[model samples]
Target: MRSGTAPPVPSAPARRLLLTAAEWAVLVAEWPGALPPGLSVEVPGSRQRNDAVAALVARGVLRAPVGGPVEPVPAVAADLAVLRRPLLTVRLETGGRGGRRHGWFALGADVVVVVLTLPDGGIELSLAPAAGLGAELARVVPEAAAVTGPTARGGAPPTGALPLGLLDAAPAGRGGPPPTAAEAALAGELLRRTAGSLDCLVLGRAGGPVGAGQVSWLATDGGWVGLRPHPGGSPRRVVDVVSVRPADLGTWVAPTVAALLEGRA
Candidate 1:
């Protein structure tokens, strides 16, 4: 081959191997730590681990560190942006007393709970109250609380009644079928309690096909917590009053509920 002339193109599998090597370089640069256990790049063909490691060495992205497994040069801002896209954005609002002020970002259906920590060491929790949809809300979140009117003579307002309005309004540009009967009832209760304060509340049913026996619940600060049980559960029950702050409400409420009801947060 002439000097500077490129070799014939490699086979498709070979080309894929090259690409995998390139991706490994990128991953190393983004994560300087050793490949966390169980982390490995997929490759074409049945290649041994040594072969993969050798290919990465040729790419110059991976280098054996004195005391570390492998390290990449510090990533630039542009690279950092690319890496950040997959990350979940969590926003926390703090400012309550006695470790009671906290919020959370909960994933709908997934049941992933991202608890929000406040500056005052307060942790937000949602619970069902006696005033509104008592145990109903508690069944879903087990922490949601109903909020009646203002507090009694000397007591403060309910724990979860922030001034942000009940659920944030649905966003625009969203087109989907209406909620199921159970979801509709849940949304209705939320709306009834927060109507004056909020524009609307989103109620999202489980994405899968709606079945006949899905259950639902509602909670308000000081109000009752109502539980409309599924087929096997006992009759609906209204539980005693619990306390909840507005900040803690969303943490317990499912994001699907927010997304389905109001298109936006």
Candidate 2:
């Protein structure tokens, strides 16, 4: 198996159910024998199915028909139980003029799942989960969260939280001044100049500027750019920008946006 961190702890009930289910599925898939008399098999409360079989073996509900080596089912179940309450958190950051696109950051008990989404574009989710479920999910959604950026290539950016200002400055729409020719031209210029550097570009109705300051761009060679107008100013003046690269961009952008909408960011 590929090596990586452990997975987040599922709830106890969830974990138990998941383990039970895995036991049943495995029994049905492999053993195909009658369940011992008066012995009850159940799925864990969590949705994990693979763990169910492991739980059964751990519980001693199923024994090897050959009477050779007993599977270490109980030990595995205990391990799963221990992981049920693992602590984890996810963060997201959105950039560009439109705010429709974003990046994600996930910090779980043992792994992380970062994602990025571009306006009217495809989604990119990255898995950094601990062992167990997180790793299992990584296998399930390999296409959804492929790591292709600098970090995957061993050139990660400095490890630091994205500036709150950058998160706040995510665009309200496509990163254009307005429907007017000048605004469209400026927005196009920004995209043209920063092609491949920017994960997304947007232009639409701008939200009022943030706070007392007007929107501005942070200079970076290859990163993200956001645009928003100054707070309390006319929406027309609302333009914000930030810098992000195509790879690491997803790691902190999408999950943050999801968290914000969920009132967790």
Worst 10 residues of 2 by lDDT: 142-151
Where is model 2 more than 4 Å wrong at Cα?
1-182, 190-223, 227-230, 245-265
lDDT of 1 at 174: 33
In order of listing, the candidates' clash counts read 51, 72
Candidate number of the best TM-score: 2
List the candidates' TM-scores in order: 0.21, 0.26
Best by lDDT: 2
Alpha-carbon RMSD, each predicted model:
21.2, 16.1
* Model 1 global lDDT (CA atoms, 0 to 1): 0.32
State the local distance difference test value for candidate 2.
0.34
